[model samples]
Target: MYKSLILLLLNTIFINVLWSNDYILNINDDMTAIKVTICSKRPLQLTSSLDNATHYLSKTSSHVEILNGHQLRLTKPDSCHWLIIPTNTESTAMTGQLLKVPTGLLLWRNEQIENDVINVQSPKAANAKLVNHSLPLPKINHDQYKWPKEPSFMSLFAYFGDFSQKTLRISEQSGSNLSLQINWLSKTLDSQYDSLISWINQVARSFVATSVLSGEQTVQLNLFASHSSESVPFAMVYRGEGTSIDAQINPQASLSQLKTDWTLYHEFAHLALPFIDRNDAWLSEGLASYLQYPLMQKASVLDEREAIEELWHGIRRGQTNYQELSKPNLTLAQLSSNMMEFRSFKQVYWRGAIFWFQVDLKLRANGDSLVRLLNRFNRCCRDLNSIWQGESLSAVLDQQIDYPFIQQLVTQYNNSTQFPQTDRLFNSIGISIANDNQIKVLDRPKLNRFFANFKAH
Candidate 1:
């Protein structure tokens, strides 16, 4: 009987310990306030991502105190709760009704929390818009909840108040799948909904067909109507516990205009590899620029000739920018590292693309291609959490295919002061530049066959 009693006591203690890391987040009726309950068995130290977190707090348990900027000390963690009333609920555009909850209030402990579960309770009404967050918030056991890998700042970003949601499930030829959740924050885009969805599907399909995405991935797309006149004003990809994209579109843009826009294509193309470090911005931007046209061509938004012409024009722009911005005694690596200070974006991006184009030509000459290499790399070495430097990325690619060209180019171009010469490379691939600087594709059998095979894949 004593043994049985001890066993029952131990089991109770174990359950408490396991549930201690769980959290309950109750979003108030108006969606302007959030109540956070920390289910802890003992005292804990908490950290906040937002420096002005105290300003948002309406009520807190007596045990909780602001120890410092972005730091919260919990003297008695048991049954502790805090009510946060956020005030930074401004929309990105003036005409948009979207009010984002300043829910960047990410809380963490001194010890890392694993398999953190957050139970979210929100008022359910037909007109009440569902919260759009970067992390997955699915209905689990009759409650809206999320299972985050760990508690971090990225997990805390969410927008509430006004939005329409749609989901697209895409399956590629290679069996890779993507569940894309799109949140339309701008009511002006309602008329272009179908067109926007179609365009997004096409771009996603093209990426998957090229083996840029492997396994199953979920992405959250937040669409906001921009004040700019451009078709797609801007777009950015955020990575943390998961991947999300924030895109701004013009309300007046047509479906055809949206499809032809390169902004979304370029943003999605960024998923081709692991996130490159900011210092190696050239490499990351270069891959996107180089792949954008081809991806557009593959999606039937642009034909082969148009893609080639775009590439040629882009290369010329890069070359021109390099010539104008080149500083004496400054290497490409130095320029790339300080590109923002020098305003050498075009040169950095174009030079990176030129390097890739040259590498592709060399690979094709050896009866291999960049696509094939990337397909292999995606199958083996794609890690969401990994941040790759230019040299490290090249080394990994070389390991996959036993090819030394990628690393060799990295070493050569990093120290070189001049922009990469692509005249020979283009000519070998059966491309030429006319006197007027227009791109002309010659009758090159191998090149034609390669592209034909490329399209088919």
Candidate 2:
């Protein structure tokens, strides 16, 4: 009994120490500059995504030296180092000024800060907004707040400004409920607030239900309303510190139009997997493309036939892109690695969808499924901040099953210069292309059953 009690005491002490805040941020009243204080004496290096980050650093600091246009090096280690970063106020939106969490931008002895807490001291007029894996920050005092968990390297992106905020609590049947915090960065979105929130709630619930992810989760969605007439002009998901999405929406667009928009579904589907490296973007983009249609169908935004048609349309676009951009010697992996340089998005995305589609068919043949595998992955291995290489992700998934199918497919497709052959695969599932270039969904039992099972799931 004594030994157990001693062990428990030690564990409690360790937990507290591990979660202790290591950095303090003091922001000025105007939100134009931030002063950062590192709690540790360790030598620190700073890197920024900004091209002229050094120009923004306070010139009075002799200890800090410019390493490059994007990086800074501290000359000597001290008990505490004060770094000040100034913001370009004129260039940013009126809703918020982004003050990046510098603790997240640092390298301690040239390594990532894996276990540090960042505490913020800001003026009451300015609110610090950051998405992190930990529970919402609790205020120490009226002006002081600390992040409760170890900061994910990716979670360091933060913004400070006066903004409209709304929280939606979604109840889950199993595990913990999901807390979605929506930050409206623009006043223009106010008109569609009710409809927009409703659409987000529906899709978020649909995602959780379809993926079977029951963990208590928090998602921070920053909605930036644009004046453009387009609906949901663009959106991107960020992971590591926490799951957050930045979506540019048009306030003028109807809720029905928002529900049917493929961009939102695609971005939400990304939550199913860990952050994959950009070199293997084909895998990540492919998974999102493949799942988006089904997700829309499941959410009732698209019917069975409509979903299948959309899928076919995307696949055909991929095929057409590959034919036009085909390089005689370049493999899919090579093209995927330099995808941006080659503008091979359609080919990479669609080919990736094809890869997953084929894998799903194979899995279904054995009474297993991509959905089941993804559910299992979510339950066991899905870490929002964890970065995975393509083959490494495949290897991990392959370990979950009896046969090594995922890795085999990845290897074969990565090496082949040709686009994945899907004629036989589609025919086997009762989809065919007519000579008139239209896709026909055949009335075979296999195809009907596939659609039925898809909707039922």
Candidate 3:
């Protein structure tokens, strides 16, 4: 009798331990179970069968669990997804009670399941608006930020702000769009924000889809003084306040005067390109840089001389070695990896734009222009997914102009060793290359001859 009681007690303890080791993610659905193991090591590996299921892994910060046998059961509450398994875990300690807290990646699959419902707005019943405004303002003596009465397609949200003292409020309205309220503590600051909104909305009119014009789609542009990440986490950032059109008083150099100059034109230009996936990232980024100067000139926002100078600037600062650039293009993976290697190569931004500029110049010489090329891209290809890395673009050009010459131009641009001598090209454009490496337009040739009418502005 005594022996029997001890055995029963041990069994009860084992059940309790098993239940205690589980981490409940409260998932609602299940899918094909891909075997995954977690470990406290450098690399995690999953079995070959789970290769197709690796994309759904997400890491959570709520709690840590170190299982005994160094392993624990991972389950999905629902049944339509596949899970990815991590490879670095030790199989021996696969199941048990934890000894210490360790960071482990959570692996799972994408399956359709009902999400737990919760009320997001109910907590703040008294205040209808969600507002945060602890951002520091520029010392410039001006109230610059205020939204216009005219309707706009853009909306904005800011986080990590103190609402009571500072001044901005963003909240969803009953309609599809959101309400943006910017209260500059200083009136001058309000004016700055107002000017910013005016510029943004003016450019945004072309960006809104025609079908969505009446339908509600929220687009917000959040501007803040600084982010913990230093640079803007997103492409558009609130760097600083400008006291004058030319003087960008960015003390932190949040947005350098030079970058701001480019950013204003480039960010606005993105509306013209297809924004579906990474496939078109090359075209999108390249086009943004390519169009920025031309568009600015068209609007009479900058001088044609200045725009050409900027293009030349890109070429000067751009990469010269074609082999190093081509090495990354051998495979998609290498190309992606090279993007992260900022120290080694010039980004697609500079190099790609310069290449397009050369292509444009070459095309014009052959009686074809970028305008024709753009119309072709817009009509023939839907977006990047439809356009693969092949001879399709080249083939399209052949129909319009001299295909052989265009190909030779592209080859020259792609080859780092082949570059037009700066001194020669600059002089041809009526710009003199200075000994100190500054662009001096000897005569500042007529804008009509070089760029569109807007460039002469």
Candidate 4:
């Protein structure tokens, strides 16, 4: 009896001593009962809860209790979490780490817990944005773990807002090297989503030949209105033919059901852009815009005449807005230097697309075609590690298409002080730019550009 009592007393003392250490460890799964001893270096009001428990805030209390089996349990203590995640938790659900506070939270997990902080971006304390890191609270932890480094705004959107999107099985495709899945949560005319998916998959098949990525890789598609520090996360808000903003889709778009097709096609093309030096924003964006018309034609979404007509209108509209487009006088160089500017960057889509349209005309005159040129460009872009730029692209185009025409077009666009006369340019090909108040087929010499191209091919 004396020996048993002595042993029990030793165990009790060990537990108390362990609890007094600087950190408390937790590794809980779907069936776990996690316990955390909350501490705050600064006076803090902690607001937190488990999956099924009611949220509780402790402005005066010293501790909070959380039951297990919850989805996400966060402790926004006055300061960042300072506790060390014990070594045992490394192979459990808690291995993947996320500090549930602002980016300024300079804390780490495990042995890295001593003042070694991964870089992060913090929003104003007034506004609580989604934390940029992936909430890697996976139930099954692995042996080899790669903690996420600091995320860009684009990546932050991918990590946080994805949880909020409702599931819509947009489309899926697999290639030997890569796989892609597309889905949009909106419930309205899902047909637009379907069309976008079809167009993207066609581009992927033609460019990446990814029809075999059954299980190795997967990509998810989502959309949102106000994403945190993200670019291209917002859908096109079309307001008539000349206006669109990434921040808000024009409430007035769908002026006619027919116009929605090109808008969708334009956004979907962004998905296929190659991993190039972002400095080549003009090229990738311009190429994508230029390619959209042809891809739509190939997919039967647009005919030859419709494609050229669209380009003419885009150019005219951008030209009229020329004063505004150049107001900032930010060159493609400044725009590509950072993504923040890329979000607000103006007219690359419009001006660059027109440049390509002119090049297409010139190439056809020289017995070459846009379709063949794009096939070559796509091949160069497909190499994952290769970086592409205007110089490299010009070299490739020189071999397959009209290089002088491309050069002149690029120069005119890069240096243009005003928007081109889009309607007058279209007049050269026999088409008219439509007004926002009216849609009509012009009865001029627009010997259907589409039909001529199909015939020539």
Best by lDDT: 1
Worst 10 residues of 4 by lDDT: 136-145
TM-score of each: 0.83, 0.77, 0.44, 0.46
Better candidate number, 1 or 3, judged by lDDT: 1
Residue-by-residue lDDT tens digits, candidate 3, 361-392: 66666666665565455444523332234235
Candidate 1: segments with Cα more than 4 A from true spot: 1-21, 40-59, 62-85, 88-97, 101-104, 107-116, 124-156, 326-328, 450-457
lDDT of 2 at 65: 61
Clashes of 3: 47
How accurate locally is residue 400 in candidate 1, as Cα lDDT from 0 to 100? 69
Which is better, 2 or 3, measured by lDDT? 2
Top candidate when judged by TM-score against the true structure: 1
Residue 345 displacement (Å), model 4: 4.6
lDDT of 4 at 214: 26
A best-first ranking of the candidates according to their TM-score comes to 1, 2, 4, 3
* Candidate 2 structure lDDT: 0.69
User: Which residue pairs does candidate 2 place in steric collision?
Assistant: 155-241, 240-385
Q: What is the C-alpha lDDT of each candidate?
A: 0.70, 0.69, 0.37, 0.39
Candidate 4: RMSD to truth: 14.1
Choose 1 or 4, whichever is better by lDDT. 1
